[model samples]
Target: MLRQSSRFVVNRASAALVGRGRRFSTDLPAETGGDSKFVDDWKKVIPNLEPPKTPSAYMKPRPQTPSTIPSKLTVNLVLPYDSALSAKEVDMVIVPASTGQMGVLPGHVATIAELKPGVLSVHEGNDVTKYFLSGGFAFVHANSITDIVAIEATPLDQIDIASVQKGLTEFQQKLNSASTDLEKAQAQIGVDVHSALNAALTG
Candidate 1:
């Protein structure tokens, strides 16, 4: 009987020890699996850090800074009382040249033309502004600058045609009556100016 009781107690203690060992073994695998999974997840999110790569010959070159050189006509038109027109990047300027009616453009050849009494036309894009200049000197520079020094500049619409015609008739009468060379020459100049002005207004 004593031997049987001792055998039963030993069996219970062995079963308890086996159950504790199984729990330890199962918990160890779960804990280890969770830790390994956490490490793998962190590794996936983290990025490898390195310095940025420089351009190679295979890559296209980046755009460089544009040159500071001017590429348009710079006109400085001035009158005695005020600055008439100071235009940069003007498309074209037309004036009555002593040689003929002339148009000044960007990068034109260097020339100095004496302006006469006519409509001075300044063109920019699609808009044109006309100014009746009595007389002026246009200096064209090779560096794309045009300087217009006008004695008098008035808007084309301001001058009345009737007044110009009356002046023309008076100048013509003065030219016919003049007995001296200087008087005839001066009167002729007046007639020519009035005729040009009339032409400008009508044309």
Candidate 2:
């Protein structure tokens, strides 16, 4: 008797859904460019309440992928205070990733790499520029666009080798004399950064 009653209830529910001819909430809304379909329905249900705008209304549309890969990669290197490079097209870029130095070229696969304290190189036709970065991230997009954000970046030529050598020696002494874990860690970081700077300059 209970089974028959349950079946009847389910049958009635299904019949009602079929009879109404209205799509369920799970059904996809028709494409209306960027506007939300829910906003239209909400306005009809509650005329007094203001409808909220969707993120699509505020966000800009992404560029469509081209059939052929681009010849040059568009790069943008940004720092905290200023833009280092903006919309510059280059043949290749080499970044010091945590794993190793990664070389990126045009039509490279999308990737996000964690940077380390090392040199970042940008290669054009005949000229190559180098910069030393403290640390940051590199984002490679599918559209042959690369974005680099660094905590600190200085031109390779501007770095002082003498200062780096002095700091390295001082940090080595501090690391040897450090008694606490925090001190050791701090000294180690200083040593690593100085070492990287020295290597970038000499190597």
Candidate 3:
């Protein structure tokens, strides 16, 4: 009776172990040859991967826009007093007008304007620089060209501050002793010219 009861217990334990093994096999991944459908259906249920981040479109540098009206005429830039500026572009001229600074580019309307004594800022493409002119009249044509007839054009780099100051002092003395309207006008022009030169130098 005792041997029969021990045999029955052993058979029940063996059946339990087989059932656990079957359960474990069903829980394994498909790659391991288990009956798991999870791997096959995973891609359909999961969300798509996102693209990598990129720089904002607004942050990119833009190319320069082409001018609508192109100039056909060739410019001739002349600075009688400064030899260094003779090599600069002849067109797209900037001249100091009597009233203010005037900018001339190609396709500009034809006009003649008086110039004041001041610094003329010239721009060729993105690069810009300045030249000092005492007095001049700028003539612009419809052909997109300009001619600056200047009394004197001085490069700022070539100006001697001490010499300019001396000229200013002498002109001031002449202003004080002016005996005629013409002399006063000449003195005033000299003072204005020197003042413009000093401003360009200091700037």
C-alpha local distance difference test of each model: 0.72, 0.82, 0.59
User: What is candidate 2's CA lDDT for residue 35?
Assistant: 49
Off by over 4 Å in 1: 1-71
Q: Count residue pairs with overlapping backbones in model 2.
A: 0
| Candidate 3: C-alpha lDDT | 0.59
Error of 1 at 1 (Å): 99
Residue-by-residue lDDT tens digits, candidate 2, 96-169? 99999999998887788999999999999989999999999998876788899998999999989999999999
Q: After superposition, how far is residue 128 of candidate 3 from its true place, in Å?
A: 2.8
Candidate 2 off by > 4 Å: 1-59
lDDT of candidate 2 vs native? 0.82
TM-score of 1: 0.63
Q: What local lDDT does model 1 show for residue 40?
A: 44
Candidate 1: tens digits of C-alpha lDDT, residues 9-45: 4654477478454221112232224234333433444
Using all chains and alpha carbons, the TM-scores for the candidates as numbered come to 0.63, 0.73, 0.54
Preferred candidate (TM-score higher): 2 or 3: 2
Q: Could you arrange the candidates by lDDT from highest to lowest?
A: 2, 1, 3
